[model samples]
Target: MKVFFVTLGCKVNQYESEAMQKLFEASGYVRADEISEADVVVVNTCTVTAVSSQKSRQMIRRAAGANQNSIVAVVGCYAQSEPEVVAAIDGVDVVVGTKDRTRIVELVEAAISMRNEELGIRNEQPLSVVGTVDEIRDFEELPHAPQRTRAFLKIEDGCNNFCAYCIIPYVRGRVRSRSLESIRDECLKLKAAGFKEIVLTGIHVGTYGRDLRCQVSGVSGQKISLVDAVKTVLDAANPLRLRLGSLEPVELTDELIELIKTDERICNHVHLPLQSGSDEILKAMHRPYTTKNFAELTARLVDEIPEISIGTDLIVGFPGETDENFAETLEFIQSQPFAKIHVFPYSARAGTVAATLPNQIPSSTKKIRTNSALEISRDKSKIFVERLIGRTVEIIAETSTDGLVDGLTKNYVRVYLPDENIPLGEVVKVRVEKIFHDGVWGDYVD
Candidate 1:
């Protein structure tokens, strides 16, 4: 059988889809380059925003309608949250949520056989494969890494912080961390497979190990922090570089800051999502930290690690955000020494507290505010990359085409260099020559 996959959403989803592909391959299934050519199609969905959910539905319908003979299976966050809706779709043969995807090959086989046996029977009974989302209390560890120079290693899953504007916690359930031994083993495997960098990713990465104890490791019986997880990978795998996903400002404790400052192996880039810069809006959104607290953390990070690139996420038009509040947010973000910013207009997801809140900002206002913040982000990014011109930095070459190679610096700045027969995934030094499109043009050094 041939399998084709359509994946959406965060790095976690990407990693999971890769794992699913491996599962199918292990069962003697081949991969198809296109959905139309496959005997089995998997639609890995994302429901982070209404837009994402809509796109997922569209893909599922298109996959089912495009090829009537293919077995259409829907999985991931959207399926977990709305299995009934997905099942009612015209062509979804099998449906499983976030969990039980490890048994997807078996489920697909069973679903196909059942459908064949009951060809004329009404498709009344839904596929009996849905897994309980909340019952997932243990971390799902998949030791597979997608083929890439940098691999995203999911060390934790789910979230406890249900930010009012987010639907992730509901779909992902509570926090569950991968054990230190599991993480170390995965890292060693990825390193042995020639991955140069490993990115620690999760729903709420900062809260890793908060609910679990170290198991069968040197740190056994002790609670592990995000720092401890990183330390484990550093000691066990010793990859060229280790990167972290977005983190909560409150989780940037003194110990964490000190470790990042002292360790050169850890990438000098941090992305903190400041949903709204206005304290009033933050409270309304149920975000725990204040503008003052966030500002202090950024200040300390810059002071300690001078060359660090600090990125942030900001929402433009949240409910109850008055003109003054927006102005405060705009001013606050501009005042910070952020290397880059990811601007998002508030997307009110159903079941989120902000969805029912009054005083919703208009679409025009959201557009204007989002554009303004994006302009600031562009300026910040330009300033950050410009400063790196003429400096020699270490980077792992990722892609090459037409005699041009592209890679990312340790600070996560994309750098393009003329092809020098440099092998992909090889860590090499490059001296920044000048500012190019969105990044810097560089030449390989030695």
Candidate 2:
């Protein structure tokens, strides 16, 4: 059988899609290049925002339209939150939630067989239901080795931080961490598989071991932290580079900062989301930290790791945010030494508390604020890249196309070099020559 996958959302989703692909491949199923030719289709959906959910629905319909005979499966956050909505769609044969993804191959096969058997009897069969995310307890670790040059290893799943504007915790359920032994084993396997870089991903990676016995093991031997998990991976796998995903500000302890500072393998890059830089707006959004706290943390990180690339997420036009609040946010972001900023226009989903909040900014105002934020982000990014000129950094060659080999530096700079017969996945040192577009033009060094 042949399968086509449509993956949406964050890196965690991408990792899960790859894992599912590996599972199908192991069962003698080949991957179809397009939905039109596939025997089965899997749509790994995202519900981060209403837009994401809409796209998920569109992709599901498109997949079904492309191949009416195919067994269409819709899974992930969208399915977890609204399985009934997905099942109501015409061509979805199976609806699997955030949980039970490991058994997707079996479910898809069974779905195909069941649908075929019942096709002659009736054309209005209900879709098969897998498990719901609410009952999810253990972290479902994917047992497949990653195939890419840079592997995203999900060490944790779900989130307990129910921010007012987020539907993630509702759809993803509670925090569940993978065991230390499992992490070590996976790290070893990925390293053995020749992946040079490993990016640790999760719904909320900062609270990695909060639910486990190692949550408070500093003075004792009982608790484990995200720092401990990183150390374990580094010690066991010793990958050339280790990168972390988005981290909560509250979780960035002095010890964690120190570990990143001293550890040579850990990339000197951090993506800390500062949703709304104004304290008033932050409170309205139910974000625990204040603008002052965020500023101090960024200052401390810059002071400790001078060359570190700091990135952030910003939400413009959030509820209760006035013109003054937006101005304060701009001022606060300008003061920080951020290398890149992911600016998002406030998107109020149906179930989020912020959706019902007063003083919701209009779409035009949101766009204006978003544009201004993007301008500031571009300036900051330019400054960061300019600072890299004449400096040599290590990069993993990701792809080569059109006589140019493109790769990302340790500090997350997208560097491009002229095609030099450089092998993909091989780490090479490049000296930055000039800033090109959002990245830099670099020449390979021996």
- Model 2: per-residue lDDT, tens digit, 1-446? 89899999999899899999988899999999888999889999999988899999999889878977888888899988888888888888888888888888888887777777886331355455655566677898776656578989999999987788999988888999988888998888887888889999999999998878743335445777898899988988898899988998988988899989998889999999999879988988888899889988998998998589999999998987899999999999998999999999999988889999888899999999999999999999999999889999789999889999888888899999998899999998898999996799999999
- Residues 1-446 of candidate 1 have per-residue lDDT tens digits of 89999988889888899889989999899999888899899999999877889999999999988777888889999998788899999878888888787878998888778777888342445474776667678887664747567888889999998899999988888999988878888878887887878888888999988987745457667767898898998888888899988999999878888888888889999999998889999999899999999999898898998688999999889998989999999899999988889888898998899999999999999999999999999998999999988899888999998999998988889999999799998887899999887789989899
Error of 2 at 308 (Å): 0.5
Query: Which candidate gets the maximum lDDT versus the true structure?
Result: 2
Lowest lDDT sum, 10 consecutive residues, model 1, at: 120-129
C-alpha lDDT (0 to 100) for residue 389 of candidate 2: 94
How many steric overlaps are in each model, in order?
A: 0, 3
